[model samples]
Target: MDVSDILAAQAEKHKAIAVEKEIPLDVDAGFLAVTDPNPIEKESYDENVEEYLQSTARDGVQVLLSALFSLPTTSSPDGPLAQLPPPTTTLPRAKPLPKPKPPTKWEKFARAKGIQKTRKDKKEWDEEKQEWVNRWGWKGKNKEEETQWLSEVPANADVDYDPTKKARDERKARVAKNERQHLQNLARAQASGAERKQRKADIDRTLATTRVSTASMGKYDKKLDGEKKLREVKRKFEPTEVSADVEKKNNLALLAKIGNVPAKRSKHEGNDAAINVRKAVRFASKGEGGVALARRAEGKAARGKAGRRK
Candidate 1:
């Protein structure tokens, strides 16, 4: 048997790998995804649903695989690796974009004046030290005036005036002023938008509560002519229009729970004697009560002796 015919048939079978349709399949090799936009063939789909679906799916996969193989590959230890380009498809964000932070007073002023922001270098060249030193950190160039041995004193300087102390104080004042401005900016940011409204509402509620918390509960207090009456919140309860059977079942369940609870014991129930010890004590003491029985017993002998002598 000649195998040339079998080889030719196999080549013909593999020749038509390219799928054709009115709308081309969208293939993203980077994302390894294929989208088929062609309308389904009604006759083929109606004749055999599973076969038609499988052929459609196979065509899409064939196209995707062909695209993948066309990409340039690099040699690797395991095999040749194809480097995928950036994905063309854009995906939606998982979460909403964050709100912009409120700007500070300085930022607003700078924007209004059309001033561009410029970053300062962290390190500056020191001519005396012949090296680059930090601008504002430990042993930085900014502290040179305070750390220097000699300083220029003003003509009106006081007797106790020290140049080093003055320079240090000025530096500290600048740091304090920067910190204060930072705090002010933070306060301004927090006091903006919905948060500010919430804070104001809380304050109003607190004030209303305080107004009613007085000697007479604000009942006898003088009220303004245009003042609105405060409406107290009412308690919520289950509706009376519920099904009778459901209500009956609920009532029975409640009764069952109440029945399961143990009853409260009497004060003398703790005593386990055959007779009622508390009642006997009360009778023996002539209704002076069980607690006073000991005191009565202590005075009984003295009373008996006094009666006999009489």
Candidate 2:
């Protein structure tokens, strides 16, 4: 059945039981009396009646069950009640937060000056010392102020004030600064060495390339010189005299065909004989002793042939 139907049936049964017993069912008062160990009395009956009703309305079936199964209460002054174990449930493991780094000298100074303090209604500056003064008189104000306070011995101060902590902080800062400079110098030396090595490598590569190029050019120049020498030797040893004789004969044959000469002259005839023949031909053509010159030439030829036969 539906929950509401079940609840209604149960209420009806309770009402019927109450009626059958002929007892007034002060449900709220009964619930409250069962729940509360020490119930307060009301002045008016109506007010008490309203309180009991409210208690019953606030609880429901839970109140009825507790009332029905309640054990008899007995006071024992010697011992406490037995405690129930807490409920167990699965839970995630929480990661631990990182520990905060120790504050530096500057940070400590700022904190002492109350620069890191939370803002509040009362904030005042001491004009004479140019510092902030807290009304609460908290220890951290500034290094100078803290020092001043430390100088003045207080009767009830628990913690001892010493300048050793500040001295140690200064020493740490100096050491850190020196270490940083040393590392920077080491890095600079390494970088300079690397640059020098690269430059040397580049120069070597250029020199090697130039050497190879020069060698190749030299080989080409040697090949050209050899070819030029061969050409020169061939020209110097060529048959120049035979060629010149053949050229001269060709020129003479061309001149004879053009009728610029009377006949083929003796190969032994000198320049003076050729010049006299030219002058005799010029005198014969002009009809001056031309027949006499022809007769003299025939006589001289006959005498030369007779001498050669003898």
Candidate 3:
């Protein structure tokens, strides 16, 4: 082989080797390849980048940087800046409140004048109606107009007042008084009823006692009269046609039955002796020859007695 053929052939072999290795031979192409691979190279390059950032911050150099070098670059007309948007600001709005209603005419009058209109004492003026009125007098109302009719007389008129209302009140008071009196009367009647009941009870008790006493006294008197009658009957009648011995025995039994002698025994004996003498005189009179026959009998009796003595 000649020297030219050997050099050309060696150059062609080197070209083929570059093509097989996929390595560009152009300087600009190589620069692009190096720059393009920088992001892959920077996968562990944060340590060095942090040191560089700290140095740049100390030197007061503002710079724009991205973690991925392949990312698109940002433009700044002012200077190198941090990769961030500006802060948003907003102002607060104020809300309005509702207003209160105005005061009424009457309320305003009350507040300003310090006086209130009343039914008993009317006010001098009506602000809404705009009219004058009596301060302390009656004011009639027009029913059709629905407004007060002022008096023709002066503001203060003294009308003749009727005390009939006062009289009516007095009448009511009297009625109440009468009611009170009626209640009192009822109370007294109740008390009187109780008293009457008590009196009736007392009368019944007295009548019961009187009846018992009268009955007892009447029984005692009747018993005494019966005893007197039995004694009189025994004295007035005696057994007739009895012998002297039997009579004497009967008299002794009657005396024993009569119990004790009387306190005036002498007077009783005297009357008994007198009654016997009277009975003997009546027997002599009843005999045939009155007093003469009695004398002859006495003479004969004397002679017989003399002969017996001799």
Best by TM-score: 1
For model 1, the local distance difference test gives: 0.88
Sorted on lDDT, best first, the list reads: 1, 2, 3
Residue-wise C-alpha lDDT for candidate 2, range 202-225, written one tens digit per residue: 987675455447656434543433
- Residue 248, candidate 2: how far off, in angstroms? 53
Q: What is the lDDT of candidate 2?
A: 0.56
Clashing pairs in 1: none
Residue 118 displacement in candidate 2 (angstroms): 51
- Is candidate 2 or 3 superior in lDDT? 2
Clashing pairs in 2: 28-52, 112-141, 113-141
Error of 1 at 32 (Å): 1.6
Which candidate model has the greater TM-score, 2 or 3? 2
Using TM-score as the measure, name the better of candidate 1 and candidate 3. Answer: 1
Candidate 1 residues lying further than 4 Å off, grouped into runs, are 1-7, 112-116, 119-134, 137-140, 146-169, 206-310
Model 3 misplaced stretches (Cα beyond 4 Å): 1-165, 195-310
Task: Return the TM-score for each candidate structure.
Answer: 0.54, 0.14, 0.13
> By the TM-score metric, which is better: model 1 or model 2?
1
Lowest lDDT sum, 10 consecutive residues, model 2, at 224-233
Candidate closest to the true structure, highest lDDT: 1
